[model samples]
Structures are given as C-alpha cells and as structure tokens.
Target: MDLMARVTAVVGGVMVMLQRVGAPRTQAVGTKPVIPSARKQGIMTLKMPTAKGWASGQLPKTAPGLKVNAFASGLDHPRWIEVLPNGDVLVAEAKEQPNPPKTLMDRATQATMRRARAIGVSANRISLWRDADGDGVAERREVFLEGQNQPFGMALVNGTFYVGNTDGIVAFPYEEGETRLNGPGRKLVEFKPGGHWTRSLIVSPDQSKLYAGVGSLSNIGDQGMQAEEGRAAIWELDLASGAARIFASGLRNPVGMAWEPVTGALWTVVNERDGLGDETPPDYLTSVEEDGFYGWPYCYWGGTVDDRVAQDPQMVSRAITPDYALGGHTASLGLCWMPAGTLPGFSEGMVIGQHGSWNRSVLSGYRLIFVPFENGRPAGPPQDILWGFLSEDEKFSYGRPVGVAIGPDKASLLMADDVGNVIWRITGV
Candidate 1:
C-alpha cells in the first residue's frame, strides 16, 4: 500500500516486542489463587513463540514416575479427540479460518496467530487410530471422516456418531468395525460460527444427550450483546427431539468439559478475558450448574464487575465464583477424568491440556497437568504430567498440549499436541 502505512505497522510491532515482560510466576493454581488487583493495559501484551515442530531427537519431559512416547505423529493440527466403545480413538485435525484483519488490532492479532500456527486452512477432517491387542501405541490409522467445517470434537452414542463442527452439530450412522463415514451428515443443531470457534463435545453418561461448548464471538461483548446470542456457554442437546438449550451461561470461553465422577456434576476449564494485565482474572476450572451464571462481560470470579462493559448489577450479584483458578492466560483447553491409579503418584482427578497463551509476555500452559480431586472437587495443588514443550529461552514452541483423555486400556494418558503435530501417550515407568 503506502510507505507511511508500512512504516507505521513496523513501528507498532516493534513497540509490542519492546514492552514485553517475562511472564511472572503465578501462585494462581488452586482453589485460592492469589489474584493481583486489576492492572489494565492500553495496549494488550503480545508475546508468543514461533511454532517449531519437534526436532529429530526432541521429546517432551515427563514427571518422575511417568514416561512419554509419540503415540502417533505427522498429523495435521490435531486439537480435539474422542474414544469409541470398540477401543478405537479419533483425533480432529483442525485450525482457525483466516479471518481478514479489519483494524490495526485485528492485524496484530492475525500476525500473532500465524506465528503460533493457531490459524490456517483447517484440514477439516478426523482420523482414527487403533491399538488392537490393548497396546499403548496405536498400530493403525485411517481416515474416519472428512470435508467438514472446522470440526473439533467427536462422539459416538448408541448407533449414531456426532461431530462438533463450527457452524453446527452433525450426525452420521455407524456400525461396528467400520473405518469410515460414507456421506455428509445431517445437521442436528445450528450454532453461531467464528470468534472462539472450537466446539467441544461430550455425551451424557447414559448417552441420552450431548453437551457442546460455544465460546464468545468477541472478548467481553466488544461486538455488543446481540452478537453474542447463544455464545459463551455450554449447551445441552436432547437426542430425541434434536433440541438444544443453554445449560450454563457467562463462561467466556469454556472449551473442555468432564463430569466429576463422584458428584456427577459437570466441570469445565474456561479461558478468561485478556487486556486486564497479566493475572487479574486467572483462567479457571469449575463445576457448572444448571442455569448458573459465572460472569463474562459483566463480571468475573463472582461479583467483581468489569467496568468496560455496560453495568448489569443484578447479573453480577447472581454470578457464581469458579471453584478453582488455573493461572492467567494459560488457555487451558482440554479436560478429561482419570480414575484413581490411572497413573502412579496420581490419584483420581482431572487431566488438563493447557494450550498456553499469546496475550501475555510470560507464557503459561504449554504442558499437561493433573489437578487432584477428592469427593468430586478440586483437592490440592496441581502436578505436572508433561513439559519441555517450550524451549529454554521460551522463544520457540516445540509443542503445545491440547485435547487429553484416558486410553481405553485404562492405563495410559493420551494428549494431542497441535504445535508439534503429534499425539503423545503417557504411562507409568
């Protein structure tokens, strides 16, 4: 375009890099994270490593009593996963659609996303992995489904398989031992697409309904409340009538969901808002209640109002505080329940895949971690399951953990690493 515009863009990018600060170590890891007072920034922090897949001898570090191996590699950005009753596993190779930048801030965001490999042409496909003989390593891989609109999560209930595509939930019939879906599936429910576009899916224990996570279209109603209709919440879908309703509200970006085994309560990991400094409102893990409001544009952590949005006192008063904090800008996106003795040194708890962050100078959540549980609630401090995804200087990401699940063999942990384009399997040493 023009010489002046080019110069202005370069100057703005340089300023962002110069203002970067090391991510401060956070104590925001438990039911009582020490939250600092609000310190908003006129220009949001923007620091991220360029995406570099694992080098020839490179691998992630694991906890002392555990070991990790590449269960499958050379996959497209595999971000979400599902396991079937027949012991097969599925991983969705998806990425963000390239939304053209409309403003200066949008241009900056677009560039950051590109460096992080969080944006690109999505494969728009799902691949199946199999480890017959109950082995930890997958011995077979096949195309299970393809040609979908940025599909993320998958589920198989009864005889129908469901997919959480960006614009809608789709269904296809399946039979035992089949390796692929035959046709374009029928849409079960329509949803607003784009923005925080990953739609994660989980079925009820009894297989009667499915729950999907739809994140907001903008950070804190920047596009106004009307643009956020039926967004930023968990939706429950009835299988019989094909009906869906908001199960919980105000969960800015709830990506991963699991049921607390003992209490049977639904729990989720939510990514909180940005531009409020490094650690004002920590990303969190909390049990979601029916019809409960947890505060998004209006408030956070229960009654703490966000003055950026138009005030809504009554909604703020009714906001529910999350049960535990996971650290600021960690982008904790994947969650799955692991029963007691699933791994050595770890008891029953949730496995979280922290997708990490770009809005903060200091990085958080490039690894996998376990949060201990007692009687179906967060019990104590978290423990690392895998690390070393980031280089020592933190300027390059070899991998970033995302979707997590327990293997059908009931002994190993499976993690999807989008940055490295591999699926990792962890088991006791």
Candidate 2:
C-alpha cells in the first residue's frame, strides 16, 4: 500500500507541477546560445509524463512534405536501429540496466521512471526485421542475436558482425543473408560496464578501425574519477591487433557518431548533465576531434567552470566549445548523416532522435529533428521532422523517439520509439 501510494503521489504531483512549468527558452536553439549562470536545481525537478502507447489508427505528425508510418511495431523497447547492406534491419532493443536504489532520491527517481515506463528489464538482444518486398513496412521479425549485457550499437564489416555489448565489443562470423547468428560471439575489447550503458558503435570511414561511445558512470563524477576511468569518452578499437584506446574525452554521454561527408569530420550528439537550471548548458551536436575534451564534470560549453566538480582549470582550458546547442536536456541520443534528398526540403544534414526530458519542468525534446549542414557546420535553425509525442495536456507521451537510421531502402528514414515500442519510417509525401 505504501509503495502504491508513493507512486500515485508522484504521478499526481507531476500533473500539478507541469502546469506551472515555464516554456523552453527560444534563444537556446542555434549555433551560439547564450549560456546563462548555472542555477542549481532545488527540489530536484522530477516531471516524467505517463507513457501511453499509441491508439489505433494513430501516427506521428510529420513535417510539411513528409509522411510517417510504422516500419515495425509491437517491439520490446526498441532503442536503436541499424541497416545491413543486404537490406535487413537490425533493431537493438534495450533499456536501463538494473541498479538498486541506495538513497532516498534514488528510490524516488526509480519510482518516477516506473510511472514513465522508462524502467524495464532490457531485452538484451538485437532483432532482425525484413521487408522482402519494396514496401516500407517489415513483414517478418526474428531474433538475430541474444544473451548480451544490454547491447545498443551494431556494425558489420568485412563479413564480420560486431555487437557493442555494455561491457565490451564482440564479433561473430556473418553471412550476407543469415537472419540469425547461431555461433557465440567472441569479445574483442572489454569495458568496465554499468553507469551509462549504451555502447554505440561506428566504423571509421576508411573502415580501418571501430569507434564506440561510452558514457560516464556518474552524473558529474559524483562517484569519483577512479570510477569514471575508461568512461565518458569514445573508444577506438584496432580490429587486427584487438587493441583499444580512448579516442576522445569529457563527452559526458555521447550516443551517436556520424562522419560529416563534406569535411570528413566525426560528429556526435551528447546528452548534457542535469541538476543545473532548465537551460544552463544545452546538449549539443559537435564535430569531435581526436583526443578532444568537451567538458563533462569540471565545465561545460567550452570552459564554463561547473564549480561543483573538483576544479581542473587545465582540463577546462582544453575543452572545445560545442558547435551547436540542442536545447538544454533534450536528451538527443540518435544521429545519422542524411544525404541530400533523403527528405524533401532537407539536404545534407543530421537527423536527431531526442528521447525527451524527464527532469525538466517544461519538456524540451519529444520529437525527431533535422539540422541542415552547410560546409560541414550547422547552417540554420533546426526543423522538426516529426512531433506530437506528448499529449494535448502534456500529461502523457504516446511515444518517444530515440535511435535513427537511413532505412534499407536508402531514401527513407527510420527511428526507434521506445515508449511506443514502434519503429517509424519517414518518406516523401
């Protein structure tokens, strides 16, 4: 009874607080958002919308000239998507790894996550979907691989399949059209695991090395720097030698990485830390450089000292300013280079799946967006490609967008909606 009452009280309080929350700041959207003085959050803002699966005959609202349809549905928390050259789709279904609450705040946060459907036993496997015909919708679904420690990213290179398991990178022999991987995969590189667990994998354009994005173990290194060792940075693995090393540092939580075609630069969308005011430092999309620092615990937005973490003025000095702001707490987790004509009116840019915010009073990201790139840099304001995730009253979300990929068809766009358990495909109207 007590547990039920606490959950109920939290849900009820969510409705009350959301009504009084302020709107997202407009100036915080472009190449140079005014970074405001950091105001520590009191009462630790917790405002998660209740998860309500989509109703019958429902669809996400598309942009002016695009249309959206369910490429795949009835999934078990499909969080990321990848496409193979054979035109098969691999959906990485995962969620938060189990962690017992050690403090009162932890318990409260877990309860809130439950109310929001953000807490679930990770499926810990990748499922393959196929569209044998030229249709946009997938006709069959089957398990491709299983028994992983919360796998998120996947890659196929030189006839070998790689799974970015939370603890390490594993490899298995793969054929062109096999729907299932029967043999046990061998681990190539090991990670510490736990903390932020989404290990996104990408192959360098030259196809010489593999890169994986590993997030920090604590919000702001609260658990100490030792725990954060081998974390909060991107790791590069040399396939031939089976050797790995950190490629970049201080990214906080870098989820997606894509090479900007024009400049041959690696770009990523990072989820900035919370507890700061609603818009103190926005999550950003920036070109990542080798051995670069983007300021995790000690600073943010290029040298803005956090003062909360142990001061590292020298490290802060090396922190490179991010290229573009994604609105504070948007939770932009997905990124893919959309070549020109992938969508109408959008040309040569990045598509981001903002999973939305749970702690913000006024929610920031519950939609899929596109930022056009010109000469390897963000050119103008962002454009919403799909929205209407939240309810009319802002009390519920029918679905939340996450990972994104160009569909097997090559011209269409695909996105994972974890809350709704669906993968949306967008194409020209």
Candidate 3:
C-alpha cells in the first residue's frame, strides 16, 4: 500500500475513535444518530433520557401525544407477559436456582454449570396484575400459581391456561378476572431440561395443536444430533388426545413463538448457537414448517456452516431455511402481531423484542422491531419501531424487553422488562 494512503487510513481510524470516545450525551440533531462503524447498519440505539421516578426504577416517558405508563411494579423476577381481554395481565416470575460449587469435576462441566446459574433468574410463579378502575395503575396484584419449575411460555385456550415449565408443561382452568387457581395445576407434557431454558408455548391458530420450543442444552455440537437429551427441537402436542411428537428439529435456542395472523403459520424468534467469534450464527425469525430442520449445532442462516461443526456429515443434508435473519447475538424474544386496523401503519407487520445480549463485547438489541410483511410474507429488512432502551456507552440498561403483547385496549403495546421487574405500556401518539 502507498505510504500516503496508509497515513490517511490511520488518521481516519483515529478520528472515528476519538469522536465516539468524546460523543456528547445530548440527543443527536437529526432524527437518529449516525453510527460510524459499518456494523451499526442504518438503525441506531440511543440511551434512555432521564425521567421522574414513579416507582423504584426510571420510567420511560413518551412524547407529548404518546402516553407511557407503568401497569404494575415491585414484582419478583417478571419475564414473559400476556394481557387478557378483561384488562388483566399474566406475568411469569423466572425461577431462580441455587448456585453450584465453584469447583466441579472438569473445566467444561464447571463452565456449563456457571453459565446455567448466571442466565437463570427468579420467576417460578405466575402473577396477575389487574386494573379495575381504568386508572393506568394496577390496584390488585397477586400470585396466580406457585410451586412450578422455571415456567416461561404461557397460553390461554378455551378457558384453560397452559404454562410451560422447564421440564414439563402444565394447564389450569382460567377465568377472565380470577386471580388464583382453585385446584392443583394438571400436567400436560413432559420433556428433559437443558442448560438454555427459554421454552416458548403457543397453540395453533385453529386451536387444534399445541406448539412448544425446546432449546439445545449445549451451544453447538454434532456428535449427538438426534439424541433425546440435547434435541433442540420444536414439538407439537394434541390438545385432546394428549399426544406429542417432534415438529421441527435443529433449532439452537428458539425462545419466542407466535402464530402469524395472516398466514396462520408458526413463527419463532431463535437465538442461534454462539461462541464462533463475533458474527457466526445469525439469530433468525422464521416460520415453523412441518418436518423442517433448522440446522442447529451445525449450519445456520441459510447454510452458513459453522467452522467448528462444519465437518459433521449429518448436517450436510439438512436443508435449512429462515424467513428473516437478524444479526448475531441479538437474543430475539417475544413476538406478536400488531393489532390490525388499530395502528395506521402497523396492520401488516409483526413486532419482535430483541432482548440484548451480554456475551458480545459491544452490546446489541434491547429494543423491539417490526418485520413488515405483505400478503403473509416478509417485505424487507426488519425496521426499528420502539428503541432507546440502551445507551451507546453500554454501561447501563434501563430495561430488558423480553415479551411483547397486544394490549387489551387494542390501541397500545405492553412490554415486559425482566431486569427492572415492570411492564411498560407503549401507546400511539
């Protein structure tokens, strides 16, 4: 390379570094901040502005016409959330486990146990938050169910509420405003538990089948592809007959699942296998086709084979497909269809919450995005809808959005912040 060209490149790199290091905290002049790195793409992440404290943590205040309110607070380890038609909300308090001993049998085993403890949080019970008076505040907050193992996914079907536990599935009879269950919850399905325990539960659009996602125990492997333990597959259950079978396999960590309204197809937000450097396996938002293999523990993002597991002969034939793929380590979660005809421009799109990741050096996600579709298919790249949950500095995050649910009013969106233990209500301006 020429000496002058090399000198210019070095100076430009130094200038970009200095600018980012000394960037002002004030809001950027234009609509969105321009990120100098090619990795930022077009979307920008902004730090949440200061606001008056309502409860314990900071509340995100919306613009003049846009109203931001906290539905409930002071909960213990709240995670995935669901809003009922009668203005009641159901929240899964993540179940916490006791920390294991520092010294283990081997280094690999100890590392696995440590990661398991770090990711796990306290939410073994379900809590119901009800606002009887239309006051934007919840007056009644009570536990709906207890003694359940690390439950995450939840669905209400024909007056029956189903909960997805770490190792099994259970169902309870649910009334519109009832806060507690009368009898013990009945077991629906049972499965082996793994390290990554973000199981998502959903039923078919016609209410005929129950769909559940089981993430892989290990990040990536090819030795035990079809083994019963680290299966990393999506399953379908017969609601009436109590029968269950694998629907799709090779998904690393399918955390969020929702049935698309327009296509009536199951769409999942999957966190693909990590540890292959900065950008190896891209987390994907894709439809769950029958008997499909998503190439986990081997291939990812449209046959982009992993260098670690590429030599596995079994993965060579598994044809993989993804509708839309987000960048690596975004930790996509909780997807829902925007209420049709309610918001002017969101009728034809789906909203997904990208629960930011901590593994990467520079954190990404911590916002909800809209993947627009036309005639029941993806239109283009995913667009940022509600962001500003994390700052560019990456030191502090106000809230980690894990769940997205269309509100009971049909005019607003409810996001569950697991870290802050609160539910944020976002309304149109």
Candidate 4:
C-alpha cells in the first residue's frame, strides 16, 4: 500500500480505539486553563457524529417553561440569520465550495470534512421568511437575493443592505418590507480568501462604520505570513467613503460577533487551533479591542507559549487573554445577545450556538446555551437552553445549531441548523 493508504489505515484503527476508550476527558467550559497534554505529532483523533434528521413528531428538548418548534424547514443549509426592522427574517443558505487537495494532509482534512458533513456545493442565496399573523411560524418564505459567492454575514444601514460574501462585501439598495432584490450589488472591498471562508459583518453603534471578521488562510499560519495579509483579523470599513483598515489582529478564526448592549464593546467567538491534545488551547468568546492581538500561531490563552510554532518572546508577552473559554474544538459559531424583557428567566444574556466538535474522541456543543451577563461581562455559568441534538449514545446527531437571532416579536429565539436544514424557534411558555 502507498503512504496515503497506510495513513488512512492507521487513522481508521485509531478511531476504533477511541470509540472503545471514550473521550480522554469531560469537556471544559468557561474561562479556565486546559492543561496541555500533547499527543503524537501529526496523529489526530477523528470523532464526528453521523448526521441524522429528526424523527416524526420529534423536537429538541428545551428548558422548563420554554417551548421549541420548527419555524421553517427544508432549507438548503441555512447557516446564518438576520432580523429586519419590519419583522422579516433573512436566512443565509450556504455551504463551502470544495477545493482540490494538493497534499496528503489536504486529502486527510477533506476526508474528515466529508464525515462531518461540512463540505458541499454552495447554495449562494438568501431567503426571506415573514410571520405576518404574529404566529410563531413563518407564513411566507421567498428568495430575497441570489447569485452570490457564498454569502454569510448581512447588515442594513440607512437604505442599503450589505452582505459579506466569502471574497468581499457587497451592497444592495433596499426598502422596508421588500421581499426581492433584483439588481446586482456593488462591491465595497475585496478580501484574500483561503482557510476560513465565513465573513461575519456587523455595523458599529454609531452607524458610521462596518466591521467584517475575516479569518486566517491557514491554521497557525502554515502558508507563511505573506499569505495572511488582511486576514485573521476584523476589518473596519467607513460607510460614507468606502475606506477600510484592520481593526484587530491575531485572532485565528473569529466567526460570530456582537456589540454588548451596556458597554457597546465588540465581542466575538473564535475557533482556536487544534492537534494540541483534546483539552488544551480551548476555543473562546472574547471582547475585541482596537489594534489588539490575541495570540494566533504563536501563543494561546495569553502568554502560554505554543512550542509548535517558532517562539517570539516579545509577541507572546503582548498577547491578551480571552474573556471566556467555550471548549476545545467545539466550533462555537453563533452569538447574539438577548434583549431585556424578552424571555422571563433568560433575559439579559448571550445566546451561543455551538456547532459541535470533530477532532476529539467525544462530541461537544451541537446545542444552544445561555450565558448570563452583568455590567457588560459574562456573569454566571452557561445554562443549557436547547439540547439533545446528539443521540443518546453520542454516535449520531439530529441537527447542529449555528446562527442565532431574536425573533420579530422579540420574545422568541431563532436558531439556524445547517445539518437538519431547519430553523428552530424557542419561546418561553
């Protein structure tokens, strides 16, 4: 057998061993140290639950006094969501376009992605769902826009609607309650794309600038720093003049971003590096600072040097610690703050949709969680609001939660589940 075949055989054996032994440790949550216990270099554990759709008359379990129901179904990989001023919900139905493998590692990565159901042709469209009668379910669904390059993040400022496509930000003229956008949008800025393709966009509080999160082209800068220009950082764009600049640097894969209502500070959820054992170097939710660096490809969790990379003592010393650690390899993607007085017991907190894990012996995430906030910071332990996406034996998943947003009534929470092709609506009883 050739090298690729031999490697595959070895990894297959390792998966069998892991399934028998179970996870090395229970997942760690919140801001805490995940002590490094390195495994053999270049040998990664693969553990992804097989995707299974919900059974008939089945629904996700929710917290007491809260109800869970499908707001819309049969979507084509709905990944992100945005609510408009006129009570309309916009869903970004997209998937990553497959890339040709150039090396053995590339092929291995693609194999893992396939098992996780993470790779597919892009839908390249956004759909609008309106609940006109104020019922929990959407009464109208229509294609709002189409023919875009893997569009993700979306925003509206004044009369212009902006979309953060994989390669750039584009804008379309829009009016309230309009279901279709016919004209092609003009590009505001271009981005270098390779590794992390999801571009998350949000407008500043003052409405003068837009912020777009562009992740790194490769994990730990394996493609060299030159290939990483204008990536792994958030870019601030001036709405009036179209000028742009880097807002923050050294974040490996920042996905979901939101502004803290009390402090007006920007916050983001970052998917950290892998292969450092199942526990070390946890993924995190942090407050982003202007001109700040959060230690990617060098150090992690503030000053804990990653010996895998060429060490830079000065840069390590300058690294800032994250505000909270979600869990290693959990792939936490969706983030949105709860509007006060929306849900009785869950008001004034942040809702996070963890898309689950693929690099460990056991699964993590795959549910929606709530973290209570006080004085503009996370205050209490994460509360499980919606769960049971994974099977009882943990070998299969009914769905994986992604983007989250407050519903039009401001009382229900909307979650985008890419795997099950369903949008879930959660409301207090």
* Top-lDDT candidate index: 1
Q: Candidate 2: misplaced stretches above 4 Å?
A: 1-24
What TM-score does model 4 achieve against the real structure?
Answer: 0.94
Please give the RMSD to the true structure for each candidate, in Å: 2.5, 1.9, 9.1, 2.7
Off by over 4 Å in 3: 1-57, 61-65, 95-121, 222-230, 310-314
Off by over 4 Å in 1: 1-24
How many collisions per candidate? 1, 0, 4, 0
Work out how many backbone clashes candidate 4 has: 0
* Candidate 3: residue 374 lDDT (0-100): 78
Measured with C-alpha atoms, the lDDT of residue 19 in candidate 4 is 46
lDDT for each residue of candidate 4 in 167-230, tens digit (9 for 90 to 100): 9999999999899998789999999855789998999999999999999988788778889888
Residue range 16-56, candidate 1, lDDT tens digits: 45545443456576887788767676777667777888999
Ten-residue stretch with the least lDDT total in model 3: 27-36
lDDT of 2 by residue, 291-389 (tens): 998888889999899978889888988999999999888899999999998888888899999998765767779999999999889999899999999
Compared to the true structure, candidate 1 yields what TM-score?
0.95
Better of 1 and 4 by TM-score: 1
Q: Which sequence of candidate numbers ranks them by TM-score, best first?
A: 2, 1, 4, 3
Instruction: Give one digit per residue, the lDDT tens place, for model 3 in 21-57.
Output: 5333331111122212223211122112121123454
TM-score of 3: 0.80
